[model samples]
Target: MEMIEMNTRERRRMTLMTRVAEGLLKLRMAAEMLVVSYRQAKRIWRRYREEGDVGLVRRGRGRSSNRTRPAAERKRAVALYVKQYGGFGPLLASEHLASDHGIKVDHETLRRWLLSAGLWASRRRREAHRAARERRPRRGDLVQIDGSEHDWFEGRGPRVVLMVMIDDATNKTLARFYEGEDTAAAYDIFDRYVCQEGLPVALYPDRDSIYVCTREACLEEELANVGPETQFARAMRELGVGLILAHSPQAKGRVERRHGLFQDRLVKEMRLLGIRTLVAANAYLDGTFLALVNARYTVKARDPTNGHQTRPTTATLALVLSWQEPRTVAKDWTLCWRNHRLQIDARHAALGLPGRRVVVAERRNGTLAILHNKRLLTFRNAPAPAAPRLRPAAPQAPHLTRRPPAADHPWRRSALIHRPVFCPPPTSYTAHSRGAENRAAATPSRAVPTT
Candidate 1:
């Protein structure tokens, strides 16, 4: 006989039926014990007598579920997910499934299916309360900016830094991959953002040295011109854009969150397209990826008014956004840059440029400009000396002949070898020989030889 598995409730009813069959318990009493009606108890008791404990087992036990999906359909979905949407989260994959393949599945159901099939792992989300930050009123009212340094190519190419700016109100994002996150790169990023969306009302960024100068000397200098500002900050000041420095990264959480999203989805997308270089990646972003991301993620602003104002002309923008440094021209009418001397033209003699300080402007497109009092100067490039000239090679040393020693000199004296005054005593052999000689002398010349 096949054994039947029964739950606690079923076993209890079977136990009560056994007592009823033994004639110890009445039918009404068994019904009361099992919490069932008297008629139902009578039927259960009869079935127990005929079929034993098996009759208490549920009839639907060990049977397939009525709402189960077909094996073929499940296998098809799992195969598609593993092949194409492996990195996608469950809800995103479910959306793609319905949109692309007519597979109408609930997100939780698909998540469970993926989990059971070993295609997806569940992530436990942290539940910590943060300070609430309301979005701005207009699209360009406030922009949050940050740089994410990542190995975006996953070893397919060199690692790079991605400069990202997101509108706090509309969630609009502008990003470009760069070699580093420095003042020059930040200036280029702002230049691009301004050309497209005009000047924002304010920019929110971290207190990086590229964005703000924290040095004591720099703070002192800020007393004169822009206060405690870096080169990038000065450019923004010239553009009439306000900046808000975040004390903590969470203060500008919008761009930080977008960085996480890009590191995940953008990396995979670039991998699929074999985009390794920064140029190709940026082009892909401008042409296709940006539109896709904005459409999927952006939201309407609270206020309908556009906060971005009109930008300045291209020439002014270039001048304001460039890297400028003040240098004093040397006696040779040259200024040094990157170890190369920029020689001002002789024609500038009319301007009397020697020993005068001029501002050197380094443009983003790899061009150099020298300006004195806001007037452009013509200059040529030459290799600058690595070190200052030394004294003359020291004066040549005078040579002299050596003099020979005379006969009366100390070298003509007789040399002496000093010896120890006292000799060391000999061992047992020498003492014994002396004693033998004394004994022989005491014995007198017993054997005097004629020779």
Candidate 2:
């Protein structure tokens, strides 16, 4: 009986209705899966036949529905919101309308209106989550750090970026810095996190070039593992911080989701509450915002044993992460770097080793520190002994002060002479004569005159 009823609609696509008609299907299962009426399915089939894929498209293809505000006005409002209020959603826009535009609407009602008007995510497709993130057991065990560029304030200011570090186990934001996205920002953020929250056992972060580096093409083997070590990663490693690479954003969904709340609620609230400056934002975050947010969501156990240990001092870490190259000291206790000879006062009896092999750690930015017996002996940015490039020598011949001979002289090359190979035909007059003789023959002979 149910199968006969389903025969009413002609389904072109592989909907459950068509599935049942094509083969075997239980009535209950078909009813559950096939939500469309039989007639609707037939319409879909008819549309497919008539217009192919075009007819099968969902209704109101290009044009928006009536509920949407006028294009110019909606765009104006959206622009205003973005500029003035940091791009709040329709619901948040209601406050703006009342305060500035003099048009007031309920937040929920505005959301529906925006949806009906086709301005909201009702039309946006959902992205699939890829990886599973297993948060560490302890609060201080692991922290996921990332940067987000957002209009923290409405349009009152320029776009600002936040470097956020959130603890894995407790979902607590340990530290936040408002700065542009870059390696320096990450380093500064790391430095602050260390001072404030102490060093976490591990860090889960996205792969950025600064945290990694690439080597030359020919020397692939030499630089095979030349990963992110512009500076920040090196410092982190020096501090004995664990680095975990996340293949996809979904792998760090905890931070990803936090970013969403930050973009939506926290950003909007900042605008409404008039938090403009980074210092102000930092103050607000410290007061209670982060604590409340963490308490609400970070419902996980803190790692029993605090994962952090003492921060390896700068001198020690320098040996570990610095760019190292082997070198030997001279008899006079001097080292060579380019043309500059770096002389350290090892001659004093206080120190040991008169002659020994040592390592040179050259900083990418500046300064060269020497290491002996795993201890940094002296530091100096020695002058380069020779330029990396050698200038080409002028021809070995001697130079004469006087000018050279003219072009006509033997020493000088022959004077360049060129002739026109093809001349254009005469257009003004018909050319019958090759020379004066032909012209004389054509006209009355000048014989009398010649006589």
Candidate 3:
């Protein structure tokens, strides 16, 4: 007797065939129970009767799938991945394999191979329960912007921040590398996005101080019924673009999720290409990486109409997307900013700039412009005021000489032991009596009785 292995389905079919052969069930009834055609059931019954239990098993059960790649091909893919694409996720690795190495393999298949080869570890995902939010209806309706600071160069260079802007509706992404996440980075990335894709209807960003003013309102601002606005916020308002602040990281889940993806995929891609500087990283981002990401991840918006307005002119954009502050011109036609005095051109002094408010705009290129009545004014760096000169000390009066007393002078003797006493003559008898009593009081032991 030989042992046979069969799945539950196969065992059930075998029992059913035995009953049909014993006349306990009819072929038609068996066919109905098995949910198969009468002809197929007849074939199964015939095979079972002629070949016993062995014939009841499926024919292709233990054989390799016809679509499975050869062992040599699988080995090559795994080797290539370990050598060149290590640390890449299966999906990204498969994409590179197909595009770069001319190896076509499904990501799922590659994932299994990597797991079996111990090149990848399975990750347990803990997805929090949150209500799903639908994407916007048209492209450029809402864009999500955020910065991700990471070791983007993998210790080869200084760590930098990648400022990412992703469209809420289509998932189109724009990104650039900066030294830090600041107003300057925000302006640069937004300026590029607007120029390339036009002005979006609104921007969705986390409540970072770069995007929202976190400072408390001052008394003056409160009394004016106004609140402080960040430079980025002010620029957006001037461009007629709405600014929506996400209360939590989850509120802008799309961009947050994008950060995770880029941290994984973009980091690896940059490492492979040896991108270790901001300029090279940004060049690659603009030229290649962004296009690839958009092509792979972007989807058609529900509505075909573009929600973006036309982009502003270059000069207009530069003026709007700058750090602007209102400064009052002094009597000397000079403006003080950041401890530097900017002397207004004498030509513009004819415009009566004294005691008037003008906007001082610090442009992205580190240039400063003074704007009055929407017109640019020429200015130069005023020389710092000369240090005060020290005055000479006043002449001192001549010192006075002093004379010393003789050693035996009366001033050196004690008055209690060496002083003389004098008595005044009385003017009347009653006065004489008072004086005598006074003398008596002064010399208690010599008191005289008055009768």
Give the local distance difference test score of model 3: 0.90
Q: Which ten residues in a row have the lowest lDDT in candidate 3?
A: 408-417
Question: Tens digits of per-residue lDDT for model 2 on 198-260?
Answer: 767888898867565564434532464644355666666657787888777877778887888
lDDT of 3 at 99: 92
Query: In model 3, what lDDT does residue 172 have?
Result: 92
Clashes within 3 Å, all models in order: 0, 20, 0
**lDDT, candidates in the order shown:** 0.85, 0.65, 0.90
Best by TM-score: 3
**Candidate order by decreasing TM-score:** 3, 1, 2
Compose the digit string of candidate 1's lDDT tens values, residues 1-451. Answer: 6767789999888788888888989999888888889898878877888888988777788898898778888788788888878888777777778987888788888888898988888878896678889999998889998999999998998888999999999999999999999887788888889888888989999989888887655643556565556788878887888889999877888898999889988887787689999899999999998999899999999899999978799987888788888898998898897777888999889888777789898877878899888888888886656797677777777887789877776665532234336877987999899899999888856666796
Question: Residue 300 in candidate 3 has what lDDT?
Answer: 91
Best by lDDT: 3
Q: Give the local distance difference test score of model 1.
A: 0.85
